[model samples]
Target: MNPRRKKRLLFASVLIGGVAAIASLLLFALNSNLDLFFTPTEVVQGREETGLMPEVGQRIRVGGMVVEGSVDRDPNSLKIAFDIADSGPAITVLYDGMLPDLFREGQGIVAQGTLIEPHVLEASEVLAKHDENYMPPEIAEAMGESHNKMEYSKGSY
Candidate 1:
C-alpha cells in the first residue's frame, strides 16, 4: 500500500474508535444517572410508566408541595412524616434523617427513596425545590424574568 494511503486509513480507524468510545461513555452515563421527575399529580394519576412504585428497596423520587400542618417528627426516632400534594391527591413521605433547614410545610420538596408501601414514600434523600420565581441573577438574566413572581409581595415588606 502507498505510505500516504496507509496513514489515511490509520487516521480514519483512530477517529472511528474515538467516536465509538465517546458514544459508549455517554450512553453509560445517561443510563446510570438519569432519574425521572414526577409531580404528585402524575403519581396520583398512575402515570408512572416505569412501574416504579413506593416499594421496599426501590429508588425513586416523589415531588410535591408539602401540605401545611402535616409535618410531624418523632423526637426519639427522628422519623418524619409529611404530606406531599399537588392540585389533586397527596402522598405521605416518611423519612428518618436530619431534615434540611429550609424544609417546611407548603414548600416544594422532592424526596428520593423507596416506597415502603402504597401511598408511602420512605425517603433516603430529601431535596427542597426552589420556587419557579426564585432564581439566581445570572439565570434570571438568561431566562428572562417573565415567569418569575415573588411569593412575598411588597405589601409585606
Candidate 2:
C-alpha cells in the first residue's frame, strides 16, 4: 500500500473504533440505571411475554392495588409493611418513611424499591394515585380483564 493511503486508513480506523467504544459505554450506562416496572403477579410468576423474573437486588417499580387489610404499621416508628396485588398473587413491600396522604387499603399505588425476595420488595418510595379514577397506565394495562372482575371497591368500577 502507498504510505499516504496507509496513514489515512490508520486514522480512519482509530476514529471508528473510538466512536464504537463511546457508543457501547453509553448503552451500558443507560441499561444499568434503568428501573424496570413490574406488577406483583409479574414478580411472582414472571412477565407474560418475556417470562423473565426480576433478579434479587435489582431496582424496580411495582404497581398494583394495595391489598385490603394488608397495611401493618410499627406504631412506634415510621416503618410499615403492606401487600399489593393485581388480580393475582400479592407481594409484600416494606418501607420506613411516611406514606403519601392518599395511600390506603384498596388504593392503587406504585412502589419503587429493590427486590429482596421472590415476593418481597424493600421500598424506598411509595406513591398513591391522585384520585379515585386515576390508575397508572402500566397498572391499568397489566390488570386488564381480571381487574374488572376483582372488585377492589364497591360501586367504584
* lDDT values, one for every candidate: 0.68, 0.91
- lDDT for model 1, please: 0.68
- Give the residue spans of candidate 1 off by over 4 A: 1-34, 48-57, 130-132, 135-157
Candidate that scores best on lDDT: 2
lDDT (Cα, 0-100) at 48 in candidate 2: 75
- Pairs in steric clash, model 1: 54-115, 55-115
lDDT of 1 by residue, 1-157 (tens): 9999999999999999999999999999986665555555555566646664333444567776678799999978989999987656788899998888778776667787776766778888987755544533422342233213323432221
Task: List ranges where model 2 is wrong by over 4 Å.
Answer: 145-157
Q: Candidate 2 on 1-157: residue-level lDDT in tens?
A: 9999999999999999999999999999999989999999999999879888999999999999998899999999999999999978999999999899999888889999999988999999999999877787899999896655655435563
